[model samples]
Target: MSLVRVLVLEPSELDPVGPLGDWLRDAGAELEIVAPAEGPLPPLGDYDAVVCLGGEMSASDDAVHPWFADVRKLLAEAVSARKPVLGICLGAQLLALATGGQVRAGTRGPEVGPLLVAKRDVAAQDPLFADLPFTPDVMQFHSDEIHVLPPSAELLASSPRYPNQAFRVGACAYALQFHIETTPHVVARWCENSPESAAAARPGDVDDGRLRSVHEDIAETWKPFAERFVRLAARYAGSLPGDPPPPRSLPLV
Candidate 1:
């Protein structure tokens, strides 16, 4: 089978695709990273899946980063096309906004550090989330929260502080408020950039040893999740033009 073609949208230098790229590539995907500021993006039809990375900017900051509008449009288009799409952090916020949800500065302050998010009951029926643990470890660094999910969006996971930690729009488009692509080094850099945000976490949460340990835990749980996503994308890519639609509750194999 041909490798799944994935378009990876990176909105900021700080939040590149990072480990998620490695995970997807190892799972048999060919990724094309695009920085909307650098040049025009390739047509979405060329790829079978999309992964929008996190960014420091707010999702609705079109005045400052006009490319956010373009990114949201692309996300909407991909969802409409039934292509697999994964949006992280600001990308998730953009997805919510593009699909009629609301995003604003988080009312509870920045949710940073290594944390656990509980899977919603409905997640048991989701293709990507079905097999995950009840509470999965993730890295949180966002100051903006997706306050309202898109109409008809399925809530997949939540934390005590953020109710919209993860959600699904339509069948295959997933949005995650937290970060699974971060490494210890990446977290250290983020801490350096936003000490105030880092300070929001429990003491020692941003420590080098703690970051590394949490990342190891995150990798153990989320790497398979990433692989499952690639498999979903690959199946979508391999389907014949006239094949019947696959069931929404795809097998975890």
Candidate 2:
């Protein structure tokens, strides 16, 4: 299959696509990066997929950053059209709000640094998360969380601190309350600049060697998942609803 053209939205300067962009390229997907910190979203329907990256802002902070309102509209449109959508961290919280879900400050303090989330039972039936480890290593830097999922949203993963960690709404849209795109440099900058991240780190947790090892583990697991996502977008984009499979020809003598 050919590469899927993806629209990547960055809500803030502090959050870049990082390893997510690299894996998208490796998966034969092209990205159109845009920053909507101050303005509205670009004209939609020009891309095969939508990837909303994380930021430090809360989803309900449209009073401060008006662009968040526009992002919610775009996410709703993607969900309505059944376009494959991936939301990370703040992006995930936005997805929850874009639908009927709710987002609020984490009750268990900041879930920063390396963490593990156990896959939920429904994850065994999900296309993207079916093969993921029971407990996957993911980078966490969010202080807010999804408190209530929208109607019909399937909870896909959870941690001791955050119950609404990963979920899927509709058929093709996914919302993840963790960070899978951070590289070592990204983690370092986050730890240095974000007070929540720095305070959440325990001794030796932010060491270069320890962080790099976790990044490697994340890449090993998530890169394939990203490739699979691109493939799903390609297949789902053209598949007609309730269409029957084409008959195959039998080998001739």
Candidate 3:
């Protein structure tokens, strides 16, 4: 088969990324990148996987970005097509809304920095997370969180502040509250852009260098998990409802 076509619904103009791009290139996936507010999503054509990256905007911010309205439809199509869909942060919130789940404010506090994901049985042993990094730290920087886990959704991991840190929908689909693609370079930029939010999230102040170091470590720890995710997605490539075959290998490049 040819390269798996992947559609990336970017939340902001910072849509094109090097690390993610490298992975896609190595995975032999033809990537389509687009900003959220650009326009309606072209039908999920020839797409084997769909990825919705993190953004400063909220899933509920439909009034500001008209394109957000079409996100639900696209998400539905991905499921309808049985293509793997992965949502990150804001995208995760949107995924919740798409699957009849609800997302509300994080009552505890904003989760930021290199945090530990508390393992749950459903994720710790599932194909999506099997033999991968367990109890490993992942980079987190978000204000709102998902409260109600979606129907047919399995809770994957949690943090001290947010319970539903990660989840899997319909076996193949995934929604991640934390960031695994946080590169060494993006940390400074994220911290700079999210100064107030970061300050509000952490009781004690964190310096830029320390935050960058933490991000590097978190990104490293989550590598095997991401590899596992990639492998799980491939197994469902020829998937149809009520017919799930054995897992395939998606080894890291």
Among these predicted structures, which one has the highest lDDT?
1
The digit string of per-residue lDDT tens for model 3 on 26-141 reads: 65666788775766676776577888888777777778876776886687666655668888888888887787677887787677766778778776567666554668667677
Expressed as tens digits, the lDDT of each residue in 1-253 for candidate 2 is 6668899999877889988889888888889999987566777678878999899888888889888878888888787777789999998998889888998888888888888999999899898999899999998888888999988899999998889999998778899899898888888888888865578767777889999999999999899889888877777655323422332322110
Question: In model 3, how many backbone clashes occur?
Answer: 0
TM-score for each candidate, following the candidate numbering: 0.94, 0.92, 0.85
lDDT of 1 by residue, 55-87 (tens): 888887889988777888888888877789999
The pairs that clash in candidate 3 are: none
Which is the leading candidate under TM-score? 1
Residue-pair clashes per prediction, in order, are: 0, 0, 0
The 0-to-1 C-alpha lDDT of every candidate, in the order given, reads 0.89, 0.84, 0.70
TM-score, model 3 to reference: 0.85
lDDT order of candidates, best first?
1, 2, 3
